[model samples]
Target: MQWTQCITSSQKRLTSASLGAITTLRLETSLIHGKTILLADLGLSSFQLTEDSSSTAFIGVDDFYVAPEFQTFRDGHVQARRASDIWSFGCIIAEVLTYMVKGSGGVKKFCDKRQFEWVPGTWWNRFHRGPTTPSPEVTTWLSELQANGEPYRVRMVGVIQKMLSLDPKERPRSAQVKKSLRGISILSLAKLVGHDLETAYKDDQCIDLLLGNKRFRSWLSAFKRTFLSTKGG
Candidate 1:
């Protein structure tokens, strides 16, 4: 399904960053089919389209998913790049993964874990603590996700870690992230359907059957295990 429009008339009064956060929550609840979904420009709304139409330039802020560089820009202009979009997509996917493994409460706890006092009374909860460093809490939470050892969770966490890299240049492009996620989904479906990974990946029919089954799709979304229990982080 298409992402819900978060920038409604009532929401127009909200800050752009707040709109982004609302969009993120909507994404968490949306039905995301692994193979068919590819978010190339998920959180980028303030970019200006160039005359070429194929090219665009970042001019303003889209706060909640703003890259670290944008946060530190002093000159009022931030040259947001494609890598910035990758970072935003990474954050979105990370939350989606959290919701998949743990429930919405777990996602809330995850956010709480990232919060810290920026100054006397100001607190920040972005994935990055500074322009060049990731939040320690985010790193720790990722480590916990890695410890789960479930193949899909492990692989996704790895992709997310790269996506949330402090340096935008280090983040993978949208195509790469899409490929990795698709592979992970295939492998997980293989495991779920009692098929070998190779067979699932190579057999188009097998993939189609699995994707076409409503029950399978439902199971995929609702599937949960003892990952990061609700007791605590």
Candidate 2:
């Protein structure tokens, strides 16, 4: 499908002398402004947007991450990885974390001040990529979240791990996943972006049920049956 990107800012790009290619530089910045406005909306900041700096822009990736992790389902994907999905979810977490660290360092009051803008939203019909899974780096982070008491944090970590499962077989269905996320606590991220971890979990349940045809379910049933036999039904 054709790319649908938002416009953040524009700048004249002269080819870089070293790489002889155009790069992300000195275009009217969008990341920081967009982030700031979002943070303000999320109740995480007091930053305001201006006419020149407040606008947003979008662009399509010329290439997807090329990897063996792609799984074709629903619509289709190119060079997709479980980690790609994981990364998408991780970005959501990163936003939450950015809020936690909003006032620190060289960053603006809101991250929106960065020079670029991305939809930061999932692609339409984006589903589990099957050929490969997330790296250990990802699972380690997810484990950290699971070990924590914060519900939203755990859900965030778990959701990413589920999306990035190395063995597609161990991954949860989108619906069962939704159930697992049920009741997870979520707080505001940045200033304007609102997230609901609990609601996400509930919605995940619907997806799980619909994708019940995966062999993983039948295998689980058989494995469990071996451990607990009953009278003939």
Pick the TM-score winner: 1
TM-scores, one per candidate: 0.63, 0.29
Please state the error at residue 97 of candidate 2 in Å: 5.3
lDDT of 1 at 111: 86
lDDT of 1 by residue, 66-183 (tens): 5676677677754655566567667777777787778899789988888888789988777787787778888888888778688778878888888799887787755566556655
Best-performing candidate as measured by lDDT = 1
Name model 1 segments beyond 4 Å from true.
Answer: 1-63, 195-233
Query: Which whole-number lDDT from 0 to 100 does residue 197 have in model 2?
Result: 33
Query: Candidate 2 local accuracy as lDDT?
Result: 0.31
Per-residue error (Å), model 1, residue 94: 1.0
TM-score of 2: 0.29
